[model samples]
Target: MKHLTEEDLVLLYYSEPEAPAHGQLHLRDCPECRGAAESLALTLNVCSEWVVPEPDAELGRSVWAQIAPQLEVQGGSHAKRHWARHLWGRPRPWLWVAPALLALLLGTFYLGRVSKRVESPVMAGLSNAARQRILAISLADHLDRAEMLLTEISNAGDSGAADISSARYRAQDMVDEGRLMRQSLAEQGDTATLALVDEVERFLLEMANSPDNANAAEVQSIRQRIDSGSLLFKVRIIESNLRTEGQKS
Candidate 1:
């Protein structure tokens, strides 16, 4: 018969070292493999020299006795099973309800902020209308002053008349005032008023830049433009609106 190998003997020693028949008979008859298997067993035995110490007999019995009473007091094994069943029964409903309530509150807060931003423009327009009325009234007053200065300049006989210099200076001053009021009206968000202001500003700039000895022709041309542009009519409309708003307020 074929002799057993060292590997077969080693496996046999660990698995069934106390076997009285089959494998033991083979190892006894197989002298060469038996020597190799015996060497390997000796090495394993030397490496396992670190032994785990057992607790003292009294200490082991005390620990077991203490744990046994506590376990019994807690209803023993039934407590763990009851806890596991409770958790398994209703956990998913609580998990969904918490997140759903949080999402609803967040959505309500977000919509409230969005609604406020949407209404801001309407509120701003109402305030802008009030400011526009005030600016319109101021512009009308400035225009009246400008018209008086222009009339004085038309009546002057020559550029060197005593009052001519003063009249020219006053006329230029009035032009500057008109330009400032026009700029103020533009900022008030009244586009119709701003447009009329712009036209008046351009006319004033032209007249203010003319020579001290401005001709009748130039003066008449400016007057014609002033009449045809309906600037006076626009001013009157603005004044009327101001009065109406003031009455309401």
Candidate 2:
């Protein structure tokens, strides 16, 4: 029979009083394993020793004196408990609450400023002009993207295969984004912006739903409408006026 290993002896030494009966019985019957196990236990107990120097009888009083100034009187127990509750009880909930409260306060402050601006005719007019500038900027960006799409499609060779597919998808996405922006402008209750929204919506619809595979003629027509709208020039003028008004304010 193969003799039991040192690991078996160590396991028997530390295991619960009622570990495997067979291991216990082997340790009892095997003198060599029992001696080794005893030695291992002695070594572990020696390694675990900790030596602490004894303090003088005055040490307790000295420690208490040092800590007394830092300790609050019993009357402050309620205050300390309140502080502990505030610090640890529901930190995650407070973490969420704090940001939400801050956001609400910021929103309230912003709305108050906006209300003041809206109540002033001059400021309201400038705000309307600024919005028109943004709409015009959005229109210009849409047209630029559309123009790029047309250019890509035109340059695609006979074997271009799916090269222009990504461009077409991007152009379609621009159309959708422009439509949503125009809807927002319409909701702002500004007649000038509403009119521009109508014009831009019509243009974007034409580009988005053009013949399955648009031809050069259709591209040219779209380009002509973009130029006639003078969208980019209008954007620049409105933006300049807004900047001037902002500086004055």
Candidate 3:
């Protein structure tokens, strides 16, 4: 009464040619394996619907090409499959892919940043003024997005769990994107700009960590923080300054 492993179920789910030969036959007759497969399928469908920031096409393709072979070269397929099935085949098999996907995303993002630094020749001819203007424009866009996140949270009056879930996801992305911008501003010795970005980042992080079904009190607390700091006003001031700087050249 051996059951199919998570790897086997995943392979069969995707109809990979190398999947275990009897995997389908076993699932047809075994309720346990079939249930596992269904859970895995549901998780996969949810993952497919995630709205992630689109990376540049060429950069994504090049990075994928360079790292794709490493995925296959890790261990002998038979040995890896055996280990995956034996030790990792307990409950919630879909959870196993979470860490792997997170690592892959982080690795890809790190490499993409490094690649831009390596390809600095693309911006080598730009004058200092031109670079400053470009930075200003980029900062402006970042502030605009951050402002929108704040507005959403402010206006989410009596929203249900679903609205909270959507806002949390968007807040998470805003927090991630703000990290790089904050670092850039700090390095440029723009303390005023850095402070505003830092403030917005903190607010975004709070929203990201809020309970999925945040209660009225929790939502109002966040709004109060926004009002107390005049955060939206400060953001608008910075956005206006950046726009003026961007228009200078």
Candidate that scores best on TM-score:
3
Ranking by TM-score: 3, 1, 2
Q: Show where candidate 1 strays beyond 4 Å.
A: 1-133, 147-167, 243-248
Leading candidate by lDDT: 3
Q: How many steric overlaps are in each model, in order? A: 0, 0, 0
**Cα lDDT, model 2, residue 225:** 69
Better of 1 and 3 by lDDT: 3
Error at 83, model 1, angstroms: 99
For candidate 2, the lDDT comes to 0.50
**lDDT, each prediction:** 0.52, 0.50, 0.70
What is residue 132's positional error in candidate 1, in angstroms? 4.8
**Model 2: lDDT of residue 116:** 59
- Any runs in candidate 3 off by more than 4 Å, and if so which? 1-119, 158-162
Alpha-carbon deviation at 166 in model 1, angstroms: 5.0
Models 1 onward score TM values of 0.37, 0.31, 0.53
lDDT of 1 by residue, 80-139 (tens): 233324634533323222223222323333454678553433223445445444444445
Clashing pairs in 2: none
- Tell me how far candidate 3 lies from the true structure as C-alpha RMSD in angstroms: 16.7
